[model samples]
Target: MCGIIGIVSHSAVNQELYDGLTVLQHRGQDAAGIVTSDGRHLCLRRKNGLVKEAFRTSSHMRKLKGKMGIGHVRYPTAGSSSQAEAQPFYVNSPYGISLAHNGNLTNSSSLQRELFEQDRRQINTESDSEVLLNIFAQELHHQNSYRVTPDDIFKAVAGVHKRCKGAYAVVAMITRDGIVGFRDPHGIRPLIYGARKTEGGIDYMLASESTSLVTQGYEVVRDIMPGEAIYITHDGEVHTKQCAENPTYNTCLFEYVYFARPDSVIDNVFVHKARMRMGHKLAEKVQNEWKDHDIDVVIPIPDTSRTSALEMAMTLGVSYREGFIKNRYIGRTFIMPGQKQRKKSVRQKLNPIDLEFKGKNVMLVDDSIVRGTTSKEIVQMVRDSGAKKVYFASASPPVRYPNIYGIDMPAANELIAHDRTEGEIAELMGVDRLIYQDLNDLKDSITEGNNELVEFDCSVFNGEYITGENKAYFDELQQKRADSSKKKKNKRAAVDMCNSQ
Candidate 1:
């Protein structure tokens, strides 16, 4: 959904925050922001752009002066893409808290009502992050403490767990003392905390993925457990509390298959290794289902599927080649807001190496097929490149339902596999054959070696919402997304019309 990083260090942490955001840029592309506590006042900088663009000038970086800070890279899963919705959402009350959150909150409507009518707080933006910040600020306000204690932080976080329903991993700057991080009761999102000793003292970082911690030269302590709250004091003391009385660990399985970086590890499971296992398991399916068909060359769709493609090629005794060269300038097509933009991005994002496809039966591997737009375009590209046939392979099972939890697939009809059989999907994509990994194999690949985490939130593929099913709520969300998309389109159209004048 999004990427977040928080740090409590003895030194000015602008460079570290900037670099961490850059590394986690893949998780979000719409906007980036950083909020720092100067001990006296909270310094905030946010904009609707990539991380580097957001901090293009040294002036932008220098404005945020603090030893403790938190940053966010956003991909609008809960709100429309705009400067106003970009996070490190600041609420000027109860220690001047600024919050950045990843994943969506399913009970945001109810929470908003409670904030308005009961708590008498007003939310400024469309972001659920702001709602969360207000709720947290309200809880801390009720505590009525002169100064914040770890116990106070625990109480506020426990209150949040009780009130909010959905996946969230939050990092907030408390303005007076330090930073706070917490995960949802179901642990539907990812959060990890790590620390390392500097010459002055210990530096701590909490991030959506462990890669940020490793990149920032901090050794991972461990994942912040399900429903756990952590506070890193100004003097580098770390305090933790198990806020949720009974927490279930159901992490998002899609992270292993597609979302996370290959180098990052979440819930103690290596994402790259899990994808490789997925490839191995898919190879077993291929051997059983398509042993008669000959795949002359295995070409990965590029980027996320590289590990799985390599392992599948090795197991199937097929040659693996890098067929598509993705342009670094383009963002992920799947996350692009509009269908037209997504289609256009697919054309610009990747270029096929004709040599790999010429006069060969090419099997294309991707992590999954959501709407089938990218898959269809890639299949066409491969066919045009002189490939005799294009076979499609998916690392995970078909996404057959709407993912109301955090993923952007909110409309059921928008899903290509929603009501389509395997044969129908293959026909729709115009591929020679489609091979999908089994749902059971998908679960095993992520959990086979990891002992700390057991299950995953597979709502998109399985149609089972761990948080609870609210069809009316999800339908409302879908309508909101559609309305936002139409507004964006209409605004663009009006600008074009005026320009023509």
Candidate 2:
């Protein structure tokens, strides 16, 4: 998934967009871009680097002067990480629209063919985001009206929801009109909107997380309702309508387990609290599974697992230690786009505190293990740190299937737990024992009492894709990504080896 933000303000919004994107950088970091409209020209800048790196200079920021703007931070789930694939993809139609999207479109491949054959539109990049932008543009163009109204925007989004068959949270700028945002029919991704009245007037903004709003000095209005479309006018008036008919809502479960920042609140639940509940639920199994083994301390894998480790320590009656020192500059290895990058970043991202592991029966907690590449590396690293015995635990269950909604996971065979039992996986990782959260426990932890959210997209573990798309297509998609991941990994390895020399 990616991070998207859009703002409609009376003053220049370049700095605000930059700050919002900085807060969302943890959501994605392979590349970043921002496109702005001064009610006339759409000044755009996108590059294959972090948001700060791309817009680091004063002159670069100066170029993005606009009262309305949209920004994106990207980590490739469908396309490879490249300059052309970075988001805020622009196309000159429907009043010079530029769009940034957060979720994957499962039907994009077939839709691309239809766009070329029927719509006669050429898609340049492999990015599914561009496909989504074109779809909205084509639908808006279908109305064949010179002046577009808020109703036109709603109708266009309705058309998009009717045609598209995957998860998406989109923010689009219609040049002179205002900013419009919508979620897919399934509401598989997240989008939140907020506003603040400055000296000039009310400034309206939308982002992937509520923390962006809080950090940028705005009060959250509420989550943009599932299957809803919002339009912010030039005069700062906000209008919303439910465009999709009878849509099902399922927020991605991984957001609570791993993706979103601890401070962010999504779907009316605090992410940090969900993770703590995850730790508590996981402890139920850990308590009985490891009751016989003498455990000395609970060491979190740093960052994502910190909250869970504390809760798990409290439950298991063990001491909690920040046993791993993480390198802050390195981006999240899990979203690094390729397996090799993730593997290389393990050592580069974290180091063991010798005292915590030296001759101790240490239990390491991680958010989740996807391909097991990093888990293996961390296990080896913990062993190298002189641990008497190492036990492994996952806050979430084993990720056995693919997440077609918006996560990047390798092919079925590439997954470490694809066909292997927990005991087998434990042996493979060289750990004394491995404890995984139960599937039912996972659901209970996220939605035990939360009434606002009814269900979650747990397709990664259950293999029950909510959209009911063909399983064969997902397999092909996974294989293609797996191959690309391997190639990028080998390239990184070669570069690292050369540098060592």
Candidate 3:
């Protein structure tokens, strides 16, 4: 997943784009980039780091002078985190275009192969964004028009949507025309627009999350509709059209559970509230599973689990305490270099407070366990902190299946819960008791009355693949993951033998 933002303004928009990307820094911390169009040139800057680190200071922002701009903060999904993979990818062939994208394209491998074989277009990096840019460029070239108009841009984007099969939310800036934005047919990723009333007129902005708009002194206009394309011109002319109709809405449920910031509102639902409901629902599961255990304290893994932990604590009538202190210098364990690094990093990332857990029965709440390595480390840390007993509660259900959508998860075999029972998992983690949120409870928590905030693509949790035309492809993907796991194990064994020698 990644973060994308675009703006069409009367004044220079570099600072605005920078501020918006700063607010979206939580969505992606691996890399940051911005491309601004001053009606002539698309000034661009990108690097592998946080937005603050990439730009260094305001002087860097001053270099990009433009009335229209697009920015990106990237978390690698299908690509390596490198300078070449950093986004705001540009193509100046038929017309100068700079684009940033969020979400992964499941059919990108197939599409890239087709492009390479037929058109001989070489893909440089492993980024889906570069593939998207090449696709747009190819479409523009095929049109063979002398002058590119906003309609041409829309048609090109619509064509890409028709050919592509996966989740994507895109923001782009054309050299002369203005800023354009679109969301994939599934609407798996969020894209919201905001407007700022200025002296010249109203400036339009689009961002992956709404909190960025709020930070930039703009009121949220609305979320970009699924299967829709919007174009805003330099003259303040806003045009919108439905590129596709009645697309399946499988907005990522993980956004609420962990990815997005608490303040960000996605698809008209507050993220923090949804997580709290997940906690409340999880509490019900815990109460049913372990009626005899006395829960003295509810402790959250710091940062992401704070709100959900509070809700669980309130529902279970337990005292909540800051049991773990997270090291601010460390990045997220999941985003670290490798599996070995991730396992080691967790120990340095969090430290249990002895005051909160000493001789106490602590119910530890965490968002989710991908591979169980980090969860095991955290449980061990709590035990070492003098806890008499540790009960593990996961806000989301066990992820037995890999997420092909965008989330980076190991294959099914690597998932501790895929083949093991809860009791088995509890023993492995060295916890006294383990409770997982029921799938039904997870669905109900995200839905209110008869209205669901977002339709979930929960293949990872349920093994019920929901892609309409690509059901066979998703089935194949699941099988491929199983096969890949075996290969990885064999490779690791070979490496172990070499080391022994």
Report the Cα RMSD per candidate: 2.6, 3.4, 4.9
Best by TM-score: 1
Which of candidates 1 and 3 reaches a greater TM-score? 1
| lDDT (10s digit) by residue, model 2, range 330-436 | 87665555567788888898888898899999989999998788899999998999999999889988889877777776677778889889998999989998889
Q: Where does candidate 2 stray beyond 4 Å?
A: 288-290, 335-342, 484-501
How far out, in Å, is residue 192 in model 3? 0.6
Tens-place lDDT digits, model 1, residues 1-501? 999999999899989999999999988888899988778877888887799988999999999999999999998764666577788898878888989999898888889999999999998767788999999999988899999899999999999999988889999988888999999998988999889889898899999999999998999999998999999987788899899989999999999998899999999999989999999998989898777878988889888899999999999998999998889899877656668888889989999989889999998999999888899999999999999999999999999987766677647777899888999999999999899999999999988859666678988988888888577887777676663564674465456446644
Candidates ranked, most accurate by lDDT first = 1, 2, 3
Residue 382, candidate 3: how far off, in angstroms? 0.5
In order, the Cα lDDT scores of the candidates are 0.88, 0.86, 0.81
Q: 475 in model 1: Cα distance from truth in Å? A: 1.2
Give TM-scores for every candidate, taking all chains together and pairing residue i with residue i: 0.96, 0.95, 0.91
Q: What TM-score does prediction 3 earn?
A: 0.91
In model 2, which range of ten residues has the least summed lDDT?
Answer: 492-501
lDDT tens per residue, model 3, 317-340? 889999888888787776443467
Off by over 4 Å in 3: 57-59, 449-454, 468-501
Q: Over the full model, what C-alpha lDDT does candidate 2 score relative to the true structure?
A: 0.86
What lDDT score is found at residue 340 in candidate 3?
78
Residue 124 lDDT (model 1): 72
